[model samples]
Target chain A: MCQLLGMNSKNPADIGFSFAGFRARGGLTDDHVDGFGIAYFEPTGLRLYCDNRAAMDSPLAELVSQTRVKADNTIVHIRKSDDQLLSNAHPFTREIWGEAWVFSHNGKMTIKDAADSDPIKQGKSRHYCPVGDTDSEFAFCYLLNQLKEQFEYKPDARTLYEFLTVQCRFLANYGLFNCLMSNGEWMLGYANTLLFHVTRQTPFGSAALIDVDVTMDFETVNETDDVMTVLATTPLTSDEDWQQLAVDECIIFAEGHMVYQDVPTRPVYLSIEEGLKIAKNA
Target chain B: MCQLLGMNSKNPADIGFSFAGFRARGGLTDDHVDGFGIAYFEPTGLRLYCDNRAAMDSPLAELVSQTRVKADNTIVHIRKSDDQLLSNAHPFTREIWGEAWVFSHNGKMTIKDAADSDPIKQGKSRHYCPVGDTDSEFAFCYLLNQLKEQFEYKPDARTLYEFLTVQCRFLANYGLFNCLMSNGEWMLGYANTLLFHVTRQTPFGSAALIDVDVTMDFETVNETDDVMTVLATTPLTSDEDWQQLAVDECIIFAEGHMVYQDVPTRPVYLSIEEGLKIAKNA
Candidate 1:
């Protein structure tokens, strides 16, 4: 399978330290080296890069290191392809609703490829559009179409929340729908199967990578005041607080907590941090 | 590798329409058929489910379809593995920081034997405990430890932000680290290489998928006013606007706009509705 990495912080910071140990696994010290892709959110827009070759040997990645493409939001993937085509490459980028969006899938779909295509709209409802042959992309298109059809050129937060829950019901039917998405800030993530995150805030300290012997201190990096969230298909570290999502559950991670969960008769008011705590306990 | 599926919206619409097409790809439709897992975020916490077999073949999944386990947040994954070892699975689950966090990876991470069997830390910044022998878990451990060290348990937002970015950077250096993570309400995504997403709010419209002959009338199914976001390794739809993220960029997707970034200087800020036009003209 492939690996996934994500980060969302309150401020701008570099991903160099984390990448140090992560990159070693991509065909160098380890071997996820089939192909790789990455997406970073800049203040202006997004910066993305993908390579079909071993990431360890990619000179382009070297340039990326030098450029130090900084971003508060980022996604990364290393592929061991089952699709083996350029179209199947990850950290897929596209233009949606006049805004650029980036996405990446960490698992495989179970469909048998009956030459699937976007559904045909039958009424005034908006239709979803697909861009590629990958099932992951098809799911994305279907979701977009559903959103458009449901709203019909309208926008509302409350209504949107309800709509999101409804669509998640459908995604539950898909194979593995574990994914990460970003429009720059406030990263959104969902787990039908598995997804883990570590949110660190206040009281800086020291840490180290398990696979590599590299280490860093938060005190040295910044003013000992930082807020960040890191997500992965699996827990990146064994020491932090990782949260697992529930079946058929849809969450909206805003600011830095799992805020806006839709439950029947449940208290609708809670902070992001509180919601996150509640999710862990549940 | 594995596949992931997720949905976010303002309404409680079921993903059945899109899910139908997506599920087919899980095993019966496509061939991502290694294993299947799903999770949904609810007001209390999250509802999660998983099967060690193809989603299409998993009776549990079929039951789920008919049960309608709904939530505002959702995540899904399908595995394609050649090994029977439980460690070689997708959508791994775990508990962290007093919360339950699940994860799944699609690519391979080669942390290797002895090195992969490190002890996990329960709040220890210097330790990693791997339940499985996958490189993905190792990376997760490293990240968690790094967060601990970076913040040193300060619990400050700024410090947390810097730590994640720095961690992402360090991880990328090892291998492809693209991933998806969430608690319930919002999502945090990064593109170490490749990832795609779309934020759907009011003004819902029509769309189509390039992989299947499916179409969704979001206007009809939705509450006419909704907001949502979708992310993937690639663009899911064809006729919609999907944006690409820059390398090393990380974002916090909240409500519907990017609230946080890793870049030094961001462009002009715009509302959910106005940002599109502003970004377009810029």
Candidate 2:
């Protein structure tokens, strides 16, 4: 399993404060430290920084945590891989409909079961391909290939949301499929077992990091209309009210606001340990 | 217009010494400083860094130059753009056949003529699309789209080389189309006007930079069998004998050695000044 961290903002914002706490999970506060990756979507294009090293010790990660690289959308993952290959790092990216799509997954997926069910899902028949030997990257490629086959270009928000809702549930049927995906315009999260989100807006107060001893006063940092929504595998702050997303739920956020959400038709909530045990046995 | 720098090595090698001089052209030594990007293909994956700010002034560039990010293949570009948007920076990248393809161009291209010629090249009918409004990115998309349309999988090296020769010549018909492209296995260079390369093998000697007052002894840094071939828009070193490629020529280098070279059946060598004037007036 891996840890995911994501941010969506109404205006351009930096993830420096949040990243400080998140980076600690990679061999410091937690043990998901095989490799790590982060992609920040700037107006110019995507700024992706990845390393096949523990984030706690990587000099590149240190540089990223200290720098104020601002973006409207950001996705980050610290990996605990079954195989710690450099190409197996999380936050795989590809271009779709002329836009860069970024994806990161946190749980094992039974890709063989899914591929056997549909001919289009097979490797040779698919339009997108994974460069690495990870189920996460294979699933990302499969998702984009399906989207490309279904739509000639970017579709309406509602149509896209609906299509993704069905696909997310289908993927979760195989195993835990918690993930975050974005194309710089909008970010979406799917929680099969464990996920959480928190929105910060006007009348903001102070928050203390769960991993480190640092505290940030949002009142001093944010503007009157500034809005930000952050998503993670677990809550990063000790004091804030972090809402746990329901099992099999899919939520999309654009410009720091919830644009669309879908509830599972047949919700079957499972514990994180339960999901891990099944994945391991399979 | 832009300045491109590429390195293909037999073994993992750093471009810090070469890039020190190359980065100087991004703002300090020359005026091609609209933006800059560099992609280094490591064993695990590719590390891509791009900045809209001038490389001389950008802190990111400073860190990149100071770091020893070694790779077997590397592509770098510094732009002098007609539009300075961040998305327009090169070198551009896409994934094809589960492999990452990196590309950079140093001249203007008349994409309108090419798209008008074939329905397959048309935007609505293409498999790949450009996110930025640049002829270079459009050309890269068109090339990849055509390849995907013709071949279901990655073709053999000979077939690919033959196909690219024809396509490279077709693209050069529109305007100046000097470029460098690689899929991490091999690097190819097309010279319609200005491109130069230098190969260094055993008995490596000292060299001096043309842009900055810096000199380095390659003998002290390289192993006995170290082999590297460096390509750039112009000669990077003042002391070395750089070979200028013929007009309409395409050369493919793999593992620091020239694997294939194609000469135009009807060569028309044009000066750099002439190519610039035609691009401006078009």
Candidate 3:
């Protein structure tokens, strides 16, 4: 599998503090060394950095960690490749209705089954398709195509949030579907099993990393009005109260606050034998 | 206006040597310092680095100059933004047929003219549109939309090349239209006024930079079978025999060779007064 990290802020902010620890998992602290990627949305424009090299040793990742590219929304991913190719690197991006939509996944799905039922193959997903051969990208294309089919242009925020929650449930049925998606204006996070989030507001304090010997004093760097929320596959900081999400839960965030959330009415779980069958086909 | 640089190679190659001098024009040597961007096609995937900071001072650009990221096709642009916004940065990319088509322009065109006739505005360009408000991106969207309208999937190389040549002529009629576009497989360069190209092959030798105090001995690093072609708004090296394109000529390059060329039969030059009017509208 892979790891995911995301941030949504009321003001432009840097992820260097969090990224420093998150990237250590790419090779230094853990075994996910296949590749890593990150996407930052500076309002309407986007800055993306991706490398097929291990983030622990990648020069680009080093530069990213040192440079403070401030943005309101950001997503990062580190991969342990089931398919060893640069094309399958995470944080895949696509444009929809003149807005760039970025996505990264942290779990596995049955590629053969997804492709067999792909709307793109059925000629319904004419507007978007996956550039890489990853099941994650295929799932993203399907979801975007469904959105395009439902609305000629972007729908209201509430409508979009509701539609995505229903779609996330359907996708989770295929396999473990933990994902982070953003379109510059808002961020949507879905947890099939493991996900955690933490919000830092006015009374910001010092936070220490769980993976590295690094600590950041937020009070010194941030204004009193600044608010930021971070989401990750695993908690990056040891001192913060990271709220864990339940299985099949989805949350939408904007301007550092949770605007909407959907908690599954009845918990659904897949057995180990069923998961093994999907993995074998994949 | 912006500076454009592109590379097409027979083998995966690093462009650090050429990029070093080109980036100097962003601030140190010239005044095109509003922003800069570069795209590297990694076979089936893409790696893009962009900043709304001066390339001469950007740490990302410094890292790129030192890191040897090998790619078969690469495009870089340094901008002097008439409109100071990150969304207006160069090398705008959109996906077509599951392949990223990257584009950057060096001169201005009348945005009003392009928008009036935009296929997307007419409900025809369903596959792609511009995320930013720039004449360059508007023109790119127009070109890509025309291509998608002509072919359901990617056409043969020859057919696509021929169609692009005709389209370039039409776009050049609107205003100054020197541009570079690529789809990883091939590069197409069109010039309304300024464009130059140089191809380095088996007998490669030392080359001196034009904007920086740097010289590279290519023979030490390249194999005998290596062939690489570079396109730029101005020649980067002082020692190479760079060929200038005619006013309305388009060249298609693949594997460091020019596979096709289209020259206008009769040049249509816009008068200074007419160009001023278009610039004012833009």
DockQ rank, highest first?
3, 2, 1
Off by over 4 Å in 3: A114-121, A267-282, B113-121, B266-282
Candidate 1 wrongly placed segments (more than 4 Å): A28-30, A112-131, A152-154, A247-249, A261-282, B1-282
lDDT of 2 by residue, B8-103 (tens): 999988999889999999998888889888898987788887778888987778888778988999999998877777778888988888898999
- The model with the greater TM-score, 1 or 2, is 2
Question: Residues B11-127, candidate 1, lDDT per residue (tens digit)?
Answer: 443545445555667776467776666765544444444555677876546755665544555667666666433333444433333233445444444445323334332332233
lDDT of 2 by residue, A1-282 (tens): 788999999998899999999999999998888998999998777888778888898777888887898899999999887666778887898888888889999888777655465643654345788888887888888788889889988899999999988878777776668999999999999997777889999999899999999999999999989999999988899999987778889999999999998876776665657655654454
What TM-scores do the predictions have? 0.44, 0.94, 0.92
Best by TM-score: 2
Which CAPRI category fits model 3?
Answer: medium
User: What's candidate 1's DockQ score?
Assistant: 0.01
Report how far off residue B249 is in candidate 1 (Å).
Answer: 40
Query: What is the fnat of model 1 with respect to the true interface contacts?
Result: 0.00
- Candidate 3 Cα RMSD after full superposition onto the native fold (Å): 3.5
* Model 3 per-residue lDDT tens digits across residues A138-246: 7788788888878888899999999998877777777778899999988899987777899998899999998999999999999999999999987899999988776
Candidate 2 chain B — worst ten consecutive residues by lDDT sum? B116-125
Q: How good is the docking of model 2, by CAPRI class?
A: medium
* lDDT by residue (tens digit), candidate 3, B63-94: 88888888889999998766657788878888
